[model samples]
Target: MAETMYDKIWNAHAIVERDDGQTLLYVPRHIVQEGSRFAFEFLQDRGLTVRRPRQMLASPQMSISTRRRDIEEITNPDQRLTVELLIENTRKFGVTHYGLDDPRQGIVHVVAPELGFVQPGTVLIIGDSHTCTAGAMGTLAIGVGATDVLHVLATQSIWQRKMRSLRITVDGILPEGVTAKDVILTIVGRIGANGGKGHVFEYAGSAIRAMSVEERLTVCNMSIEAGARSGMIAPDDTTFDYLAGRQFAPRGASWDRALRYWRSLPSDEAARFDREIHIDAATLAPMVTWGTSPEDVVPVDGRIPDPRAEPDAERRAHMEKTLGYMGLAPGTPVTDIAVDQVFIGSCTNARIEDLRAASAMIRGRRAVVPAFVVPGSTQVKHMAEAEGLDVIFRKAGFGWGEASCSMCVGMNGDTVGAGKRCVATISRSAAGRQGRGSRTHLVSPAAAAAAALTGRITDIRKMGA
Candidate 1:
């Protein structure tokens, strides 16, 4: 029988179909973080223990501050406890942990792929919505809640209903200024926020295949915001090349066996999806989200959407609310929106490649407003510094931060002040995301750098070669 890439993975990992119509999906990995401490708390309360400790990779990054001068500083009581609890839980459960000072420590999703834990045909879950970031490695990665975390930790499996599959192919070549970030933002805008509900997206085509693994991770990282269970790309030589020498990658004979399987995980010619969307990459523009949602995106050179022109009443109201919160009026050019800050980090866009891209654009120019460049992982940070990317950013007046979420969700000490607007490469842009009354403009690293250069929402295409 013909099967989509999603089907091939799902069937391989599925244990059995339950009476409730949900399948018992075997968990290949449980990527835990500080937020999942509650699952441990629940386990302690119930006297339950982890059935597969080795399968759980725990990280304590959600509450850690990447901007702190003193790495040991943890003044916030709640944030302090979150870290303490994660440490206690990981120790208590005997799960593999990468602590604060560990050179391997980083955001869970970032560290997973960085260490080669996420390979093609893998089934993994994390306690954060952005777990899909690992899906870039061709894994069927999903985010779960505390309850689901407990289940996975105790049994190494969770229940899942069958999901429809959506195939999105962006063919042709991507222009120089346009990027995977822009392509994804353009997709969400065209499909709407709920377009991929109950579906898994298989990202294919010339542009997708041509992107480096880090860029593909950026594309999959925000699939959640578009209402998809996960987004994945077929593994190819590029994917294998990136995973070859990483820490947790299969070794010796095991690697040979793994590689052979990974090569077969791409969709077959006979595979078919429930729906398919095609995009012409040649005409794509650098994208920027004007309002709160990821779907509220437009080309960097485009104008603010007019709510009155929207055909759907509910959509019009949503647009009006988002535009009002963003202090944008209809027909206002995105270029006119001056920003107080530019943040160039997050799991979505903090890889070494992303840093290099932004640094190249920021090298000779000084930022008008404060800007930050937080690496996604320790490995990425070291690589960026080794290449003198940090020097480039600092010379351009951008603060170089350690590997942590940083201003992405305003979780730790780093935050955009109230009433300020920021152009960020983070996955989200909702109200109070960075800080109270702080508006976020979600853009690519290039767009973020352009904003830093001009202190406004400037188009990267207009920034010149």
Candidate 2:
């Protein structure tokens, strides 16, 4: 049978297929974050140690002792239990080969491919929902929960039901101010949040072909928001070019051989997918979310949808609640909404290119709102400063901060204050996602810049070319 890219990767990693329809998939790379501490303790409680603790932990000796001490200390420190325990846990199971302050020490999804931990044809797993971010490198990567993390930790494998494939092709030239972020947001609005459930989405066509590797990563990173297990763009010159000369990428003679393999990882033209979606990128506009869900989005010039107009009581009620919480009324223009804060960072859209795009927009304009720019990695932060992007952001009234998933998941000390409205480029705007009771409107980097300048939702195209 002719198979799609998802099938090719999944079957390559499949170890055993059970009669009940679950397949044991071998995990080539397991990227973890601070939240994975519980999974380590769970394994310890069951007397099943990590098969290769050295591979996961920074120091095997320290890791064992830290785990033992953290379990006992958990009872005494209620307030700092997770924090202390996680810090200690990472010392034991974390990778010592990389430094936390290293540019590669930011979000796992951002660091993995940047350090070559994610490669073409690999089956990767992480305890993070955004693990799909790694799929940008032509790999099969998915997020698993804590329990599943324990499973993968103990056995280095996971049992999963094979998902069907969805091929999404976006063709034509992208209009000015229309970015990969807008493309994905538009797709989410059309398909709804649960539209791609139980499927892997393969992004292709001329528009995707023209996107940079960083742009492609921005698209694949949000695949989870659309209910897809993973998403990918086939390896091409852009992919190989980005990988070339990277710290962990293949070097010398090996580079040529690796490129050959990556080039062949794409699905054959005759390959078949379970479903297909075609989009005209030329028609996409600068998009922003008006409600809680990613699908509850529209173009910058669009109006808030009227829930009362819908016939389905359940759906209408949900929309009504979302609008109430978002402080939006039916038919109200999204561009008219005011923003108190602006954030331009996350594993989804905080790469160097994202910083450049935002910097270009904010170069001479002072922020009309409290805006902040955080790079995905410390390395990206330093590089941007070297290129004067950091100075540009600061001159525009934006705060430049250290990397580490800042404001993306409300982790660390970064957050939006209570009842404050924010224009953010980060993925996910769920209630309390940024901070308790904070209102978040999602937009692209350019949209975020425009919002910062006007202190309201504004169209990027209105700013300039």
Best by TM-score: 1
Every model's TM-score: 0.98, 0.92
Best by lDDT: 1
Give the TM-score (vs. native) of candidate 1. Answer: 0.98
Minimal lDDT window, size 10, model 2: 59-68
Total backbone clashes of candidate 2, pairs 3 or more residues apart or in separate chains: 5
The TM-score that candidate 2 achieves is 0.92
Q: What is the per-residue lDDT of model 1 for residues 112-194, given as tens digits with 9 covering 90 to 100?
A: 99999778998989988898888889899999889999888888999999899999999999987998899999898888888
Worst 10 residues of 1 by lDDT: 66-75
User: Model 1 segments beyond 4 Å from truth?
Assistant: 68-71
Model 1 lDDT, full chain set? 0.88
